[model samples]
Target: MSLCEIVRLEGYIQSSYLAVYPDKIMLLDGCCRADVPMVLDYIKTTLKRPVTDLKVVVVTHMHPDHAGGAHKFREETGCLIVSADKKKQWYSGIGGRTMHFVDIHLGYYVARRQGRPLKNLYYSASL
Candidate 1:
């Protein structure tokens, strides 16, 4: 068993990563969706799982925050990227990633006060 951690991205976007093995990495939010730039990967690597050794990438939603980099990860890690909604998983590569649309409601919301796409914009450097 390896270590697991919930990496907070730009905003509400959170990605979880786990190192089931020293050389095996499980990216809960593999899409670079949050655009944390190695935050999650760092955590995973800190647990002895380097990106090169990674073999599993998991995407939570179709939103950019969770599916933006789905294609990149698959190319780099050569790992099986898992996600939901076949249409949502867009990647120009073979065995890019796995998209499995689960039958569950994940509460999504937009901040009425901020009037921004808070629902998916986590790493918003816009001020």
Candidate 2:
């Protein structure tokens, strides 16, 4: 049988799961944009693996803490982002863009409430 280990990496506002195998890795969630460096470091330092081993990133939702780092991950590791195929984009029009901005601030509020230090959480509304 093949062996795979799932490790939980604590992010600025949420936790992300990494499924590690001999030749591949998968992120269960996108995590916060502030967390990209931390997650990449963990994979390279702790897991002793190349960043390219990260093959897939599954975004559970459009929330800042859930999909914020997806584009960064793809840009860094060429990982495929998997999410629900919706008929309409969540952040489409001007109002939707405003909501996206509000959501990012809300993420910062949550991090502050959790006693976490402020970090850059800005991400493109269009995924």
Candidate 3:
């Protein structure tokens, strides 16, 4: 069985999950982009592992709160970002585009709070 930890983010009011395996860890949601440090701290202090030990980050949904920190996490940990293998049509339509735009804008705040600019974002869709 895998061990699960709830990564609590400040002000966001959403809980992210971290699954610990024998040799690696997996993140269920990226949480808020601004909360990257908190997530990393949990891994280091509680999980007692280097951030590099994280192997996968699964964005449960395209919502900003869910996938917001994915790109940053990937850059810091070299973990693979995973989403649904099938891109929902909603993800390519105007609504999806609008949401993505919002996410990008929100990332700016996160970057500022973290005192670092966010890198170019990318995601790998897979099962």
Residue runs of model 2 more than 4 Å from their true location after superposition: 1-3
How high a TM-score does candidate 1 get?
0.47
lDDT of 2: 0.92
Clashing pairs in 3: none
Q: What TM-score, computed on C-alpha atoms, does each candidate reach?
A: 0.47, 0.94, 0.66
List, residue by residue over 2-82, the lDDT tens digit for candidate 1.
554444344333444444554465666644333444544564555545566567777675544465555666666677867
Candidate 2 per-residue lDDT over residues 1-127, each given as its tens digit:
2548889988888889998989999999899999999999999999888999999999988889999999999999999999999888789899899999999999989999999888998998977
Top lDDT hit: 2
Model 1 spans > 4 angstroms off: 1-12, 31-36, 39-45, 85-127
**True-vs-predicted CA distance for residue 45, candidate 3, Å:** 2.1
Candidate 1, residue 80: Cα displacement in angstroms equals 1.2
User: What is model 3's C-alpha RMSD?
Assistant: 5.5
